[model samples]
Target: MPSMKQVTFRDLWQRFAELVHENKSVLNDLDAAIGDADHGSNMDRGLEKAVEALNASPEGSLRADAKLIGMTLMSTVGGASGALWGSGMLKFAAALPDAPEVTWADFVNALGAFVEALSKRGQAVAGDKTMMDVFLPAMVEIQAQLSDEESLPASMVRLADQAKAWSDGTRDLVAKRGRAAYLGERSAGHIDPGSLSSAFWFEALAGAVGQQ
Candidate 1:
């Protein structure tokens, strides 16, 4: 596959920010059921800041851009969200080559590092009714597709669909992490806002890659 340009990569985050803004209320409502009811607003604030930071800088290497976004999010966002996305993205930046463009495999490999950082920091797994519910399975599917020699665009498109289904599947899960954990049995029957936002990230990724 041709290399993924830095511009397109940056657009992925922009698309994600837009998606988050569009669904802000829906995400907050979902959180209202089980958590602080601020997931959407928190993420929106962080992503918007992240995008602004990106826009303020001249185009840079993938690592530099990712690091900028991560650091900006760390400082601007609040709560567990800031820690998770900020640190995870830092790891993602560290995993990538310091180049203006990279292959799809490089992006996916860096994504694995991002997810690993999230898993370790959050200590959550597939059934935890958290973002991992989407990240874990999406990582598995991506690896499988890579092994099967799927095209990058095709794989990302499938990932967007699979992520939504995985996020929706969270509705039946009892929360085992975060504030929702306190609700125990009552946590079931509501979608996890974090998981849905993770789905949106993949949707944004697919759209960005498609444009490339």
Candidate 2:
């Protein structure tokens, strides 16, 4: 049987950076439809800087690495994504222990902190056509799976699928927050860029954990 595995902070950030680069154009296209058309470029730049910071000092603890990543992102990325995503990362990092690896429960706590930080920062709720649409449902599913004693990889796989579904479901939702809200009813038929990016984030996380 595949045993439970601990995830190193380096593994998590490396996968995230790779995924951001891989999906940059798609994220930009999704944003052009309803947002400022810079989500892809902004996130790419931020993650690149984050990866550089991580590579430069790989000896730090996970908490320190996460802090550097968050600070780098906040400084490098432009627009609301920088602030929101950076703040979320910092919040998540704050929730983690000062260790090189994390257990399933530790990851769940960090994920919950990230969601709460993003929600508070954006002041958006479910059905708002924001990243929250993807994140909230995934959090619920992960928590439910944990309660049932599901393996980490299995739970993450389910969370990734749920995030994708919720992201796609955003096409039917009118924007109630952020720049997309300016489009109002016009945003209904377009997928949310942030939600889509968030789906990729979870999918990459699932892939990383599955590899363990």
Candidate 3:
């Protein structure tokens, strides 16, 4: 069995905050290419509230903390991405409540749940060049890999790679949803800002797991 260590909600939130802060400029640059250029600011606000919620966790378990994070982001982020991302967090919070450690399978399921929630809420599909461009392939790869074997770190690394691929590949796809969708063919050749930001976020999560 692979060794595992528990991560506190507060610690995880701080790590996420650090990840966003470190990549905020990059996210902004990516957004400038194909979006309104506010993803970084929006995400930063949401994560700051998430950190606060983590700090205030005095009752309930990890699940509740996750739900709180979801709710905070939903309330603060205030965009199509925020609503979908927040829904994903809320769904996952319910899925893994009270677990001492997260397994590879659990993590994969959570990713699927996040994507599913987004799909339901946003009603988008593959090649939409939204964040779905990053998550859909990454989740599919994760589902395929984890079905054969179970290695948390390995799954995380693979997912991160898939995310990177999707991010890069989005440059070849035309935007078909959200604000970028308005740009039509012009959206092609420019990476979807949402996709790029999501790639960074997954990479950060992989880093967090690697640290453990």
- For all predictions, the C-alpha RMSD in Å is 1.5, 2.4, 2.6
Tell me which residue pairs clash in candidate 2.
none
| Residue-pair clash count for candidate 2 | 0
| lDDT, candidate 2, 14-64, per-residue tens | 787788889899989989999878888899999989888888885856677
| Worst window of 10 by summed lDDT in candidate 1 | 143-152
92-201 per-residue lDDT for model 1 (tens digits): 99999999998867888999999999999999988999999999999888767763324777778989999999999999999999889999999999999999999999
Highest-TM-score candidate:
1
Give lDDT per model, in order.
0.91, 0.83, 0.75
Model 3, 26-119: lDDT tens digits are 7777777778888888888888888887777775565677788899999998888689879988987777737656665665566677788888
Alpha carbon lDDT of residue 17, candidate 2? 79
CA lDDT of 36 in candidate 1?
Answer: 90
lDDT of 1: 0.91
Give the residue spans of candidate 1 off by over 4 A: 147-150
Error of 2 at 139 (Å): 1.2
